[model samples]
Target chain A: MLLTDLVQELGLTPLTPQLPLDEAAGIERAYVSDLLSDVMGNAPGDGVLITVQVHANVVAVASLAAQKAIIFAMNRRPDENTCLKAAEEGIHLFSSSLPAFEIAGMLYRNGVRSLKE
Target chain B: MQLSTIISALGARVFVNHNSDTCEIDHIFAGDRMSDLLGAVSEQMLIVTHLSNQGMIRLIELMDASAICLLNGTPPCPELQEAAENAGTPLIVSPFGMYESCGIIYSLFKEDTSSL
Candidate 1:
């Protein structure tokens, strides 16, 4: 299943529903990021982005990179401004306190549907 | 369960809650080496490590991970916290060593496998 679908299945709330991450579909891979450059350098297209919070610039990155969803971590919640920006940008927003590493492990084990996979 | 519950189970100290106050968790990842982390992690994953630095933080940004757990009782540095705050990241400190802390958290979350 795609990260966006997983977020929905998990019954998580999104700070924004109009962002590119939220609107983008058929995402085949999952990518967890905390750094901007690393995502720029290595992340594949149409993947779910898992992070801690919903910042304004993250929407820019998602737009530029054409990501699928943004999952916030560390029990970090999104602010109203960030949610509005995401809705305007059409990015899928998800919040989880699971910590980046653990979430990644579960998704990987549960079968991260990569394009190649 | 709740992220706070997992952190408490691991005996980790919370420094900030950028968005985690309302976040829920399912599993976790424990490691310190960046080489091992790149291109092998998952979504909504929790990260546990002993290395707290700018490089690691930057890596986490790229990884798009859920949260971070600092082990060996290492406290978050001012720079680390500031960077995390700017990125809206959560940086928690754990007094337990890597093995013990991982064990505690893994058991609490009912997860045993590693991300790699």
Candidate 2:
């Protein structure tokens, strides 16, 4: 499904939406972890990342993997300058108050399976 | 998804503006050890870690990832920031602890995934 479709379904309005990352950028798949290296080594193409470690390096890794988007969970958020950087890079970012397991379960139920699969 | 949207979603604060390095993200890899990030390459991905050392900045430069998202509200130091600025690395700082931050991200991804 399209990313927009998923957004509409979730009834989520991006708190800091920026430039688009389309062109068949499918984030339907997910790679959930707090290990930057793990994701760099294992995550598949078009996988949306879910993590708690917020750093500029995250963008570097994502850029290499060619990910679909990034989600910062647990009510965590980035700073002002970081947000603008994301906009310029065109990396889609999101935040939530939920945990990894719950979020994973939700995505699993919706066909957004794990990289392990 | 665009990194700005993640910033918005998490209500996060930013430290650096994304440069020509490309801000688009699709994958997330969180870790503090630079060694683990050695071979893994997720184009346009995000690296979630607490390490704000200059080495990390250099790694990002070598890796060419999308941006960095720091956990526990920890941001880069002046040295790291300067390095990031010089290298043109994008960065974000979050308030939640590591585990909780991971969960929150998963939640949002699932939110959109479930609909599909």
For B47-114, candidate 2 gives per-residue lDDT tens digits of 77667777776886677666777765776788767766766778788665433454456556656664
Q: Cα deviation of A37 in candidate 2 (Å)?
A: 20
Query: What's model 1's lDDT at A26?
Result: 62
Q: What DockQ class does candidate 2 belong to?
A: incorrect
Please give the CA lDDT of all the candidate structures: 0.63, 0.64
Chain A TM-score compared with the true chain A, each model in order:
0.77, 0.81
- Per-residue accuracy of model 2 over A44-111 as CA lDDT, tens digit each: 66777766557777767876887767777555576767767766666777776654445554555566
Q: Write the per-residue lDDT of candidate 1 for residues A29-98, one digit (tens) a residue.
A: 6665555655565456777776653556777787676776777765667677777776666667778756
Model 2: lDDT of residue A5: 58
In candidate 1, residue B116 scores what lDDT?
22
User: What TM-score would each prediction reach against the true structure?
Assistant: 0.49, 0.48
lDDT of 1 by residue, B18-106 (tens): 77765555556665447545544676666776668886767666666667777657788887777677766677887764434554565
**Candidate 2 accuracy as lDDT:** 0.64
